[model samples]
Target: MSALPNNPPPNVSKDAVARSLAEAHRLTDPEITMIFRIEKPGQESNPAEPVKLLEVNPNTTASGIMPVKLMPHAPSGIFFPSVIVEVHPTELEDLKNGNLLLPNGWKVNYDRPL
Candidate 1:
């Protein structure tokens, strides 16, 4: 018996490849930013404040910063993206106090464990 071709069947639509390329291009562009709201335990969501587009560490044991405007005024909890910076509580506190300065018009929001 003849061996089947390694590639996809010829019946597949050519538009499929084009569509996939378009999607990949969109994902690669830096203009896309995913926003995730922070949620506290026992609470469905934070009504007073909400954190969006938070950056988090890899080990799931650290917190990071985001734009001040995007951060909540009275944050109950904070959410972050899968990739974040790993920092100690003390360091986070220092950052809050303005000791750690970021670029102009930028602020650091700590996502500590409650």
Candidate 2:
């Protein structure tokens, strides 16, 4: 996980980062089925803060360990700070079904898809 710099107010909006992520990564085969922002446990996070997201993709390999990605959104003018976690369909279902929990105390507060 790339630590988002705690220096300045985030210049990249979640919306912008979302768009850039899809575009820059060109997620095709395993297209994103769902997306939602996550609230890291033990802290208060406003919309202006860096985001952590869970993205569900059916074709994404379910290696048991979900891959975490950090984006600076440099291609979209930088300043975007966020973590993107790729989850397989089954993993997402497990989470929704209460069979799994986000590691390291991360919580799902925003059910609204991004």
Candidate 3:
């Protein structure tokens, strides 16, 4: 029997490869963060606040940042892309104060329990 190919598809970019690796890390050695929907300017109440477990990346080009998969705010089976940002590892402090702003304009607040 022939062995299956293990390499990624030919159309993948470097960023995609890096993200894939990061996602692998997230699956195994994972970290958690509180995700908040960034309220739009002049908007009213925000949406649901969900806590997500992500991967801890210590040596990213962007220092002190991690990858977080942003799930849909509403109750559904749809999936969303990820947002990378600096994560405050201290859960208590983050809970007390707030989290760092993400590249996607949202905020990530604490390291949640697994």
Q: Which candidate is the best by TM-score?
A: 2
Order the numbered candidates by TM-score, best leading.
2, 3, 1
Model 2 agreement with the true structure over 41-72: per-residue lDDT tens digits: 55534443456677777888776546365645
Per-candidate Cα RMSD to the true structure, in Å, reads: 19.2, 3.8, 13.3
What lDDT is reached at residue 114 by model 3? 20
Q: Give the runs in model 3 whose Cα sits over 4 Å from its true position.
A: 1-24, 28-54, 63-78, 86-105, 111-114
lDDT of 1 by residue, 1-114 (tens): 322213333553223322332244346543422222223333222232222223222323333443333221113212211112333444455556876544334333333321
Which candidate's lDDT is highest? 2
> In terms of TM-score, which candidate is stronger, 2 or 3?
2
| Candidate 2 runs further than 4 Å off | 6-30, 41-50, 74-80
- TM, every model: 0.23, 0.65, 0.26
Which portions of model 1 show Cα errors greater than 4 Å?
Answer: 1-83, 103-105, 109-114
In candidate 2 the C-alpha lDDT for residue 9 amounts to 44
